[model samples]
Target chain A: DAGITQSPRHKVTETGTPVTLRCHQTENHRYMYWYRQDPGHGLRLIHYSYGVKDTDKGEVSDGYSVSRSKTEDFLLTLESATSSQTSVYFCAIRPDRRNTEAFFGQGTRLTVV
Target chain B: AQSVAQPEDQVNVAEGNPLTVKCTYSVSGNPYLFWYVQYPNRGLQFLLKYITGDNLVKGSYGFEAEFNKSQTSFHLKKPSALVSDSALYFCAVRDIGIPGGYQKVTFGIGTKLQVIP
Candidate 1:
C-alpha cells in the first residue's frame, strides 16, 4: 500500500515476442527499481532509475531495459522475451535517503512459452 | 559486495511457540539491514530495519530482529507464532556508505515460515 502499482499483473507470451511491464508510484520517490523473482534466485535487480532519464543497470540487466520519463512512471521492457525470462517481476521505490526503506508493488507474473 | 543469507529454506513452529528465522549479512562497511515478509501472491512488506543505535530492533506484527555485529547476523524473532505469521520472509542489506547516490538492497533467497495451528 505504498501507492505503487504494477500493471499487467499476469502476462503470457511466446518466446521472441516483446513484453513491457509498467510501474507507477504516487509517492514521488527519487529511486525506482525493477527486479525479477525466481524460485531460488530471490529478487535480483534488473535495472533502476534515480531520476527521470537517469537509468542504470543492476546485477541481472542482460536482456532487460528500463526507462523513466517522469518521476511516477518506470517501465521495464524485454525486446525479445525468452523462456528463461519467465518470472515474477517486482517494482520497488526508495526515498532519497541513505537508510530509507524500499516499498514494493504487488508484482507481475510473466510467462514465456 | 553486500549480501544477505537466510540459512533455512523453511521453518515450522506450532502456534504460541517461539520462532526464529535466521539471517546473516556481509558488507565492507557498516550495513543497513532489513526484514520483509511476503504473503502468497503479494508484494514484500516491510517488517523492521537496523540502521543504527540499539541492537534489538522491533518491527511490525510482533516481530523483532537482533543485530549482532560480531556474529555478522540479524536474526528475526517472535515470542509467539500465529497461524497468520506463516509466510515467506526475506532479509536484505545495503552498505550505508556506498557512493554514487544509488542504494541497492541485496536480498536473501527467503525463508518460508509455517506456523501450524
Candidate 2:
C-alpha cells in the first residue's frame, strides 16, 4: 500500500449531499493524486497536489474539488453528489524517482443514491 | 493530447502458455510509459515502465514490456502464464517534459487478463 490510506472504504450517500474522501500518505512523496475508477474508464484523475498547498485539476475535474492543507493529506470533495459520481476512488503517490510508476492506495467505493 | 489505448477488452491464456497484452500510446513529446496490474479488490501494483535506454524492460513477476517507437506500443509480455496472473491490466503514459501544474498521466481503459489453468 506504500503507506497510503483512503478513509471510508465504503459509503452510500443520498443525492445532492456533500461527500469528502481522504487520502493520507506517510511516504512523504511530493506528488499525490486523486482518481476515480469506473466501468469503461480505467482511472481518471480528478486532481493532484504537487506540494503542501499546490494543487491542479486533472482531466475529469468537473463536479469535484480537492484540497491539500498539509503534505500528508489530500482531500477530494464532491459538492453535490450525483448518481454519476458513484464509483471507486483511488489515491496515489508519484514515486520520488523520475519516470517511475506511482504507488496506489486501496480504493474507496462510493455509492450515490 | 497524450493518451494510452488498450485495444482488447480481455485476453485469455492457458497456464504455461505465453501471453501478451497490447498497449499503444499517443503523446506530444517523448513518452514515459508504464504498466500496472490490479488484482480483485486491491490497489494497482506497478509491473514495469519504459522511460528510455532499452527497448525491452523487464519487471516484477517475470513480466516484460517492449517499447516500439515506430509502432507507438509498449506491450506487456510473459513467457509462461500463471493462474495468479489473471487480473486487470492498465497502461498509462505521461510526458516527461511537463514542468509544474498538472502533469497529466493518461490511462487506458484496461484489459482483463484471464489465465486459465
Q: What DockQ number belongs to candidate 1?
A: 0.82
The per-prediction CA RMSD against the true structure, in angstroms, equals 0.8, 1.2
Regions of model 1 farther than 4 Å from truth: none
- A33 Cα displacement, candidate 1 (Å): 0.6
Q: Against the hidden true structure, what lDDT does model 2 obtain?
A: 0.93
Candidate 2, residues A1-113, lDDT tens digits: the string is: 99999998999999999999999999789999999999898999999888888888888899999999998999999999999999999999986636768999999999999
| Separate DockQ for every predicted complex | 0.82, 0.75
In the range B7-97, model 1's lDDT, one tens digit per residue, is 8999999999999999999999999999999999999999999999999999999999999999999999999999999999999999987
Candidate 2 lDDT over residue span B1-117, tens digit each? 888999999999999999999999998789899999999988999999988999999999999999999999999999999999999999999987787555678899999999999
Q: How far off is residue A73 in model 2, in Å?
A: 0.8
Best by DockQ: 1
